[model samples]
Target: MFVKISHLYAENFPQLTAPFRPIWGPKASILLVDDKLAAQLNLSPDEILAALQSDDVAEKTVAMLYAGHQFGQFNPRMGDGRAALLGEVSGQNGMMFDLHLKGSGATPYARGGDGKAGLGPVLREFLMARAMAALDVPTTGSLAVIETGEQIWRDVPQPGPVPGAILVRSAASHLRVGHVQYIATMGDDALLSRFIEYVLNRHNMRADAHENMALSLLQNVMERQAALIAKWMSIGFVHGVMNTDNMTLSGETIDYGPCAFLDEYNPASVFSSIDRRGRYAYGQQPAIGGWNLARLAEAMLSIIDDNVETAIEKAQSVLSGYTALYDAAWRDLFAQKIGLFEVHKDDGDLIKELLTLLAKHRVDFTQFFAELGPIFLGEKKRDADNFAAGHFGMDLAVWYEWKNAWQSRRDLESMDEIRILDVMRRANPLRIARNHHVEAAINAYIYKGDDGPFKALYAALSNPFEQREEWDIFDAPPQMNSPPFQSFCGT
Candidate 1:
């Protein structure tokens, strides 16, 4: 194995070091290993298993120290409690990727809690990460899910204990805004400078043209995050936790805790069990994204320039660009979703009105877009009609009006119906990892030891855009009277 242990953060800031303790159990059955990533790394299943079981590898693992603003309050110290960075591996493309293990026992940052993960959350992240990738979303990739053959206590309604598991997550880098914030809070200018340089090199960010390296890095992160949040909004994905620690500087969606796709199109939908005030709700994500980036800007201000006042001014100036960038990306994405080849000023209003209608009728967001595929194709009126009735009930007058207006706008582009339908199909997915379905799969697996439901969901979500009759069951949302669904952080 051509493995390289960078440990850049640890080497620079020895104060953040934490030893990795091996997790002992009777079994470590590999649930899902990403073969594509394995091939890229020239690793076989046996090799991965060997690496997981090796105590030497565990000895080399390091837990990082960081701090973040959780629910708008700053925590001076927060770090990997149950996770540790094993090492880095250079892929065939020469890009370095971090192999991080979650549920790998306790570290110094465990904070009086057992450093363990439940099987349900591990499987959820594995499925959710793959599903997001299929939808063309940038996110951390799950390399594997290994059952630990142990049980952990959680707040789920179920009795006894939940099965434990470990998630092998791969990412470009585990660097987050909070990591910089931690260094900044420590008042270590030298450490911050080294950290900034490390990040620039890791992400291949050029700072020569910019007046300051900190400013350059901040701009790069801002633009990437703006576009990322836009993509999330377009697909109705609510990242339940938007803490500073959860925001990756690499622009990929990092944590999967309490994250979920929207079923009913409510602007105020919040799935994270801890977010009682809806600070990270669906409609609030973009703003929260900007806020998180601002925190990053604050952390880098000292390094942005020696003059504190000038640095503040420059950082705010860069921060001001976030809204405009986010708006443009959001508009462009919604335009594509609505089958608009070219965007006009009125297109925003049209999209907003449609969203208002969706929220008013409590329609399933994914189904609404997916049903539009057939409507644009002009192939299945009966299916479309059923969807309308199911979604809009007895009154669909507003829906018809919106449809007429949308068709008129689409027609003005003079594109073939086939081309428009193709665009719609690509923009909309027929299958999503719905909360209810995820819960059902978890229940089945934990209660009955049956992987049938989980496997079926995995297969359907793997090809989200494809239309297949067998996947119809995965298309629908949970019943209206079904027990209210809530997602947990599983920490």
Candidate 2:
């Protein structure tokens, strides 16, 4: 069945119809779609196969162009350097989304490096994105990844370094806060206006950005980012790098490089090798998200209003919503995790205490809480081996305290215990995109071309809420002294 990938194009993004080739910029591989998402989106299996092989697809993707500040330095020329928007398609629950191919190669924005990606980064994005979706966070999904059948050299030679990587990716839309920042810095106010309008009409356009609109767009964006960062925190997921370019205005989690879950809960935990100062660490994410929104606010100032002072005032006022949105979102999510339905005015304290306990115990964030489900955080038999044998760090005492509060709070045993268990299990995720597990699978598949582990990981993550005892390892954080693993700069 020669399914032409080009047929998937929905008569948009005319650039897609251009005479394309076997994408020759180092990484050149084909994508293939599995059956599950295909049926749900009404996307034919043939269309998925077509999208994978044919370089030419008739698409009218308005290949957006913009620049951004990278690492606090206004590069002023940052856009989709190594990515391309294939088009948008329906996924999960009938949501129309972006179908981009990462590692597709350099565009007008590729500023002189090998704009290629490796299999490691490709697999990392897939696992992290899928895990995020299961975690109930809005994120891009990993559609497919294939070996490009070519070599790409960065620093040191790694597995499949001889062969480059190819990835088929999915997202709500690749537009970012940095996307707006790019147009504004270019002083292309006309395009900026279009971009704003595009965002408003496509996504929920905030009244804030309008020229005469009442509610400020900056404020609405602030509220969105605030809520977003809170959701990230509730799950103990550190974005590692929260660069403006990586921050999508669509409020979807985009880049998944160097990102990690908090195995040992620490407010200052930073796993991303590039994040030396903990700038985008676990606790700092919420604040940094607000800070990034401020940059976005500056970019939208002109569009907000002609008068600079008035626009600045309006933007600042909107920024105030960051905390409240963050608080409300965090409280709500954390409360649900703990089986608390209604959030008391003081429920924030209870949530903080649980995190404090996790930090003190050095408990694997996913596993510790998930382990609570079998007993539902009830008493478990563990004298001191797991905790004291290694420096689990007084987690036993912390767990004891957490249990006392949790037990007292369980005011609904009369209610369906199964329902509560289901909620917690779904929230806990029987599987997470664990650091070592993903790394091991990527190494095996990319380096060895063995798809067994990678397929297994995808399978386990697909049913994160479903309790499958066989895939429990996918949920637990890997212990140290196993192997020294570090991520490369997927440039």
Candidate 3:
């Protein structure tokens, strides 16, 4: 079996990459393979493993270079510490996707840490990324997970040296906002110009080179980020670490470390243990998204306009547009979630009230919306009773009051009940990567040497929009535990 791997990015941008080789274990083995994604990449699991172990491919492997602001502080030197770009694979659609190997080995940017990933984090990303893909969110897809047959140290439950593994990540491109920031700080306008052109051509984004090339690039990036973030928020996802480097130019969700979905409807939720001050809190994601984009605007100020003042003005104007862009996307998505097929200006208040009630009553975020469509269609009497018993607890009056108002709002829509329910079922997911369930699945794989739990959850999440009685367990929230849920970077 032959695989056509090309070094397009490394060959085109030599200055942005360092030639490298992946250090593999003595007994590396494939653990999980996404068959659909494998087909898209035009390769089998065996061919992927063969390519990763091939000396000919290792000679062309490279670790990308960039700079980023990690948690509000600028780090001038950062890159793929434990990952290697094997190169690009052209999908069946003729579009090129980068096939990068994570947990491969140390690069020049290792910064004094082992270039290895634990089995737990490897499985977490595999499940999380696939769930996001099934939900139709723009995210980096996982092709396979390879158990490296080595033990690596990590600070997780049942912590000791844990089994090491590698993930094959596929994406539209590996370019990040930090990549642009890297060239912007090199004190070479020609180099930055070339980098910008490379991104534009790679992603096929149109920008007039003669007039304000960087400004045009900024607009394109803002549009993509707006839609991406909107989808994430609608699904209650927190990227945990929204550093400039993690904000990909392609707008796909990359780097799922410390990431978790919402359980209750609390806006102040913070899962990443390192997020001490709540900078990337659930409610703050939208604002933080704009802040990250501001950093990109700062990096592109040079080529945005010849005049510094004009550049600043143009960037600010575009930055101001983020609020409207995000708001529109958010509103449309939320409206559909509640069966508002024809959105009205007052729908904002209705949506706000529902969130307020959920937060106030401590209701399960995913479950509530999942049941709303059926409940609205005069079905799921048991779901209504369960809702009251689980949260409201003998006080159905408040719940019914809000439901009455929402139903009144829906009455205004011209679409019939069936069509309205169709809109809602599509908008609201039947399942999410809930925090406790994810932990249990990880524990099953790491502790019990059992992949059963992980496989069951992955299969349930694959059809996230459909209702299956047996998968009801997947939709349930975690029981009350001693400590609050805290996710790790798993570095």
User: For each candidate, what TM-score against the reference?
Assistant: 0.95, 0.85, 0.96
Top candidate by lDDT: 3
What overall lDDT goes with each candidate model? Answer: 0.85, 0.67, 0.87
lDDT of 1 by residue, 147-205 (tens): 88888887654545888899988888888998999989989888888888888888887
User: Candidates sorted by TM-score, descending order?
Assistant: 3, 1, 2
Residue 195 lDDT in candidate 3: 85
For 1-491, candidate 3 gives per-residue lDDT tens digits of 66788999899889999988888777888899998899988987767798767787889999999999999999988999998899988899998999898898788889998888888888999999999999999999998999888888876654689988999899999899999889888877888888888888788887873256787778888889999999998999999999999999988999999999998889999999899999999999889889989999999888887899998998998889898999989999899988986768888888888888889877888888878888657466556667666776666787788888887988898999988888889898989999889999889888998989999999998889877898889998887653689999888
Off by over 4 Å in 2: 1-34, 52-63, 89-95, 156-160, 206-216, 376-402, 412-419, 480-485
lDDT comparing candidate 3 with the true structure: 0.87
For residue 165, model 3's alpha carbon misses the true position, in angstroms, by: 0.7
Q: Which 10 consecutive positions of candidate 2 have the poorest summed lDDT?
A: 13-22
For candidate 2, report its TM-score. 0.85
TM-score of 3: 0.96
lDDT of 2 at 335: 75
Clashing pairs in 3: none
Clashing pairs in 1: none
Q: Which candidate leads the pack in TM-score?
A: 3
Which tens-of-lDDT digit does each residue in 119-218 have in candidate 2? Answer: 6677777677777877778776677666676667666324334456766666666778877777677686776766666666556656556344323456
